[model samples]
Target: MSARTLLVDVHTHLYLPRYASLLRSRASVPMIRSRADGDRLIILDNEPSGGRPVGSQYWDRDQKLAFMDKHGIDISIVSTANPWLDFLSVSEATSMANSLNQDLEEYCSSGPSFSPTLQRLYGMGLLPLVPSISVPTILDEVDHVAQLPHLRGVIMGTRGIGKGLDDDALEPVWSKISDKGLVIFLHPHYGVSSSDVWGEKDNGHVLPLALGFPFETTVATTRMILAGVFDRHPSLKILLAHSGGALPILSSRLASCITHDPVVASRLQHDARWYLGKLYYDAVAYGAEELGFVSSTIGRAGKYGTPTTEAVAGSSHMTFGTDHPFFPPILDAVKQDSKWMSVVENLKAIDGVRDWSEAEKSAVRGQNALKLFGLN
Candidate 1:
């Protein structure tokens, strides 16, 4: 609500043309099928007919700037959207990761001639994490990413090295990533297996995309907690997608389950709830109630009022996001200049939380991401 508050959208995406070209050539689940209307992205096997309509918005920088301008967004921290390089040959993945990252760096630093709206962009890079690659190769990429002038961090999927994030193989990778002081933007791609319930039902992609993605994120992060990735690399920072899925809602129950267990409880330095606070969340939960819950639970859930807790509380841990190009405009815009409904909903969520002051809201909008990524 503050006039001075800079709106920072952390949850927006742009697939580099190089990456899209790879997808176009591929013959797999995450491939893109050309169409008369526009290219359709089929991330899941079930969405065989075609996934969402893929157009210039997914890869074009001009469209990205246009969306930001229309939305009144002050700044954006862009990333490669879901289904990121997960299904490539090890050599192919590694090579492509480096090229895409360099391309992104060029895109982000594409000159400072423009004014605030079109020019306000930063990037999160990627890793070639398909399991067969050596940890050294992954670490090499981490070191490589650190050198990109405009890149803040790397985005990773839940299936770390294809063995899930909890795989012991990821430890060294985690350490190196943390060593660079880079954020690991933990976005979800693999939702719950559809075989259990969704396969039999014709619920469209709603069940898998809406529910399954978040749930997968919840499970993956929880597994990391149990594996003590946080305790090992306490400096490592992970920003979760979709407001941490159900992790914020069920954190205490998870802690209780972990604590009650005679084996797991005895091994941890802190409870399950403590680790949740260590993570950051994007404000893409879609409603004020959900945003308020996420802010209170994760921001103040564990060990509230400490010097450390105070640092992470309020809007400091939550960043705003538009998820543009994915959720296009639907319904008539209330105002001729109004942005997409998906973007407006997120803004409304932040504005609806009356308990937070202008300063708090401002932090969630941009200040947090700036400090977290050292963008300021």
Candidate 2:
């Protein structure tokens, strides 16, 4: 259709066989439980029927390619979805992480032969961030992933090698990530666990997914900013999910807070606003207004400084994504035939941005990610 545009979806997901096996072996919330209908994934502790519908889409390569073809997607930079390796013992996590990485690498590289113009696949591998594991071992996995031929980077949760991402212990990991030129698909897994806040009513998973997930990413990133991770590892490229989880909206507020606080004002290299350039946002917000607001905010980041083009450094930071397989079409036709509504919504968001030039839209559609992930 529009092959010249090189449409790429950077937010798709798949759990490798080994990882699925590990989840199945477990009796926990993040496991795949047997059901009369079929297996279902339960990521949250309390979710019973609220867990994701598990199907071949979770593991089949042909299904992934078919989804891409149906959506007119040229490439998919897939990542393992949430609740990654954080729940295992140090030794168990280490082994599982390596196995999962290898499995993912094999999957991404060894796909069934297809035309290069359609459905070329690349991936971000998982890291073993189980608590108390040595930093060098973590670095080892970082290096290991960087070396994988088809692995573009590592997808990580907010929690670092046990400590949070803000922990000084992660400095080495950051340094290595920067040095390796690996993109960090900085995703959120742990949402706020406040059951009381959900109120006396059962609103189901809506409250946690809608509010808690984004807020978790916002807090984790702000914590990293306060800790001066961006200042130290300025070259570190992090692609934030859910359109950076409200960071675009809160960046100015964060900067305002940083300016007023005596302790916070003296901390680092640049304002909280400036850090937006140092970050990348996935266009998974699913609205023209949301995507435009995200792009405008990232581009607006540097205005707080003295004066320079650096202010608009984040304008091209947006890369298109479809949180696929998770948000499948509910309608019969969309479900049976061509495009998925979820993917169509994201594409419409990109296509509908009134202020964006064709070049800018094209960049967000695929070029930005191709350059960022070294796919070119």
Candidate 3:
């Protein structure tokens, strides 16, 4: 009989007790506290009235295994949840980042108490980027994680150093990470600037979740493209969270804008569409049509101006993810029995794609991530 297919979850998260305790001790946006009415897990701006309830799933290995089993995930490359060291002082951020990375490495190596079949768990390390930490310190941490056997790569927020990912000072950090053969899992922590999107009122985190998160990722990556980061580091692989935000849909338009503007056009060797091919997208789009568009658009190769159908079929760039712990079931729903709506929607999108082979589906489910991060 054929070997059981490998299903990998490259984007899952684990708070891990050591790190969760650190968040609990603090009283800030990234911190966790119990509410009077019920426990909640809050990790965002303006969470002044205290955040969500920190539970076992956030820190418990057993729960992670159970969740993986229910979802048929063969391996999970876990990482620290968002707002990673972004709010601390420069010195404190560096220290906390080092500690968190060590903690994650230790947990994965020690082997959590779960079925032996669930033993393929792994992780992506964290980095500090607050109050302008030095590049050397960042490089040191990257090298440290690279040496760890189970540590695959680093999970980072859009903001690099302080200015953003486009800042020239961050080039060395990116270079070192790429050289180490580590995939940069580019995730978004700070959503869109509050002033630009949502006003004072709380829409139950809808603003950040629905709009800010993906848009922030799109803008950060766009800035990198315009700055020629991809051209400079052609082999540097980045796995974009949330299907590259709006990049896939807006790439052609972004290219058109660059062409029209002589000032921006003069700074780049190639157009915006050229860099789209260099990047990788996750299959987190909520609909099959959107997933199909992302796959067809980014997976296309050949000349720059070639039509999507005419372009050569390229390797699959999408992977599966469940933005868990954050999008848990509402109070009205049964938390344990009901699969997450967000995860279910993503699965359906992948299932609905036409013309994609079983091998391509397996790759999107896990193989591509395995090859990308060298997790095999």
Q: What TM-score quantifies how close candidate 3 is to the native fold?
A: 0.90
Q: What Cα-based lDDT does every candidate model obtain?
A: 0.83, 0.84, 0.78
> Looking at model 1, which ten-residue stretch has the lowest summed lDDT?
111-120
Model 2 agreement with the true structure over 1-376: per-residue lDDT tens digits: 3434888889999987788888899887789988988888998888846577897799888899988887778889999988998888888988888888888888877875335533388889888888889988998998899889888888889988666889998899899989999999888887888867777688877888888888889998989999999888889999998898978888888888999999989997777887887789888887999888888888777775556535564448999898887867666654566467678888899888877988888889888998899866
- Clash totals in order: 0, 0, 6
TM-score, ranked from best to worst: 2, 1, 3
RMSD (Cα, Å) of model 3 = 3.2
Pairs that collide, model 1: none
Candidate that beats the other on TM-score, 1 or 3, i.e. the better one: 1
Which RMSD values do the candidates have, in order? Answer: 2.7, 2.1, 3.2
Candidate 1 residue 288 C-alpha distance from true site, Å? 0.7
Candidate 3 per-residue lDDT over residues 30-146, each given as its tens digit: 777767776556677665455666688887877877787777767788888887887788888888888888888887877653244334678899887775688888888898889
Best by TM-score: 2
| Higher-ranked by TM-score: 2 or 3 | 2
| lDDT head-to-head 2 vs 3, winner | 2
Alpha-carbon runs more than 4 Å astray in model 2: 1-4, 48-50, 112-119, 306-314, 332-335
